[model samples]
Target: MSAWIRMIADEDADDTLQEVLNLARTPHGTVDNVMRVHSLRPSTMKGHVILYRAALHDDANTIPMWLQETISAYVSILNDCDYSLANHWKNAAHLIGDEDRAARIGRALHDRDPAAVFEGAELALMRYAEKLTVNPGQMEESDVTALREAGLDDGQILEANQIVGYFNYVNRLLNGLGVSTAGDVVGYYAKAEG
Candidate 1:
């Protein structure tokens, strides 16, 4: 799968683009197609890297890292963005460290059956993400009330909201740009925090 627009390869990047590309690179020294798509505008590329790290990898997020990745994967599934789905699911699985559990969760999310893998407040959060992804205009204040009722504090709810929102934004960006995982390092860019 190739991008609809031309992507500057690492070898062909100007000095500034090369620096920005470095920020987006995985441990394997390869860049994901999603980030590579921003190569034409290095500022966007830099902004993407910063936004991505803050959204999901920041130390301040209260939710577990694995669950955050799960939220990202769930959003990807809801949006039908295979590029995001594949990348995020792999990150979730790696963060989980249990192949069977991660696979089951992946199956349930892919099936759009959140109840199969999540319960209680987690399930409520998943439901919120689904609604926000599929029916943003219909979202009511009761949605936040439900998360609060399910034991999520405002900060936690905000984190979930941002994760969902971020994925929705990137999913559209990747899909609209025709970005695919081909020639990209899967899950290598994931910043795992303890």
Candidate 2:
């Protein structure tokens, strides 16, 4: 599909976005198509890239990368945002590389209890993110309490919420704008048969 969004370089964004694009380009290759479409609106894209970097490489009491990926994939499943789900599951595999954990995550995607400890708690964060993503108006104190019970401090919970909410925005923009993937990432993931 033709991407419905175009990168418009008015003045400074051309430089800034180029730099960010360079950073995204690595052995992993170019940023995903979702990022490409979103970067057409440079300001939003840069901010998101910045926040995502922080969320993954947190400066505070960081959530474990494995746990974060678990949450990310679960949230992607709930949102049905294909790129997020695809990338994050691979990320989880890379970080943990445990077949049992991946299986638990697969089960959790369907709202089944994860066979791993803390897996269900991670899913709770994801499901809560789904609620906040699609229905911010209904967010209540109880949701925060549930997250707290799952062991998120207020800051961590807020950060996760922000990440979830931000990705929801990205998901909407990317999907509606007809973004695909960086190259053949989806196909590669499918072919991995993991």
Candidate 3:
């Protein structure tokens, strides 16, 4: 089992909760329903909210948000976490500026690749993230070299690994804890699809 966020009213939340949820609202129009559903999990929610923001907003990574989202979505898919799979796939579609790549990655992660992924960092990120998620210990220098050849740097490799690793950890936690996504956030994202 894992720890899960509990729902709360605005006044009861700590400063970090208020700030993080408020910030999420500004961009996404409201704190994500997944986040809201787990509001009382102050520490977990705070850490997750911050991690997601970093995943998308990091300045050091040469990769674009879409590419990062692709990595997120792909790993989420492998881990079978419904939590971020769909939302991140669509988000990646928006970030990457190409519907096809997003759709392709989504499908590829689901083992339903229509043909082959075209454009962007599909092959490299997928191979690397998959290797990391499926077998972190098994990763070799060749894997790192392949990712570098595909345009990732040392930091990017680390970031990708960390992102994939943490999400998997969180996904398992959520599953074991019986945590569910916040409906409002899901609906918001569903509607935001434009």
Candidate scoring better on lDDT of 2 and 3 = 3
Q: Residue 10, candidate 1: how far off, in angstroms?
A: 1.5
Q: Report the lDDT of model 3 for residue 34.
A: 50
Provide the overall lDDT of each model, using Cα atoms, as 2-decimal numbers. 0.89, 0.65, 0.67
What lDDT does model 3 reach?
Answer: 0.67
Model 3 weakest 10-residue run by lDDT: 184-193
Q: Sort all candidates by TM-score, best to worst.
A: 1, 3, 2
Give me the runs in candidate 2 sitting further than 4 Å from their true place.
6-17, 26-29, 111-120, 182-194
Candidate ordering by lDDT (highest first): 1, 3, 2
Tens digits of per-residue lDDT for model 2, 1-194: 23766643324346777776665543345455655555666666667667666765576736677767766776667667777777777777667678886776677565734433444467567658768866889999999998888877888787787667666766676667766664535522243222
Q: Estimate each model's TM-score.
A: 0.92, 0.74, 0.75
Error of 3 at 139 (Å): 2.1
Residue 121, model 1: lDDT of 91
Pairs clashing within candidate 3: 6-40, 33-182, 33-185, 34-182
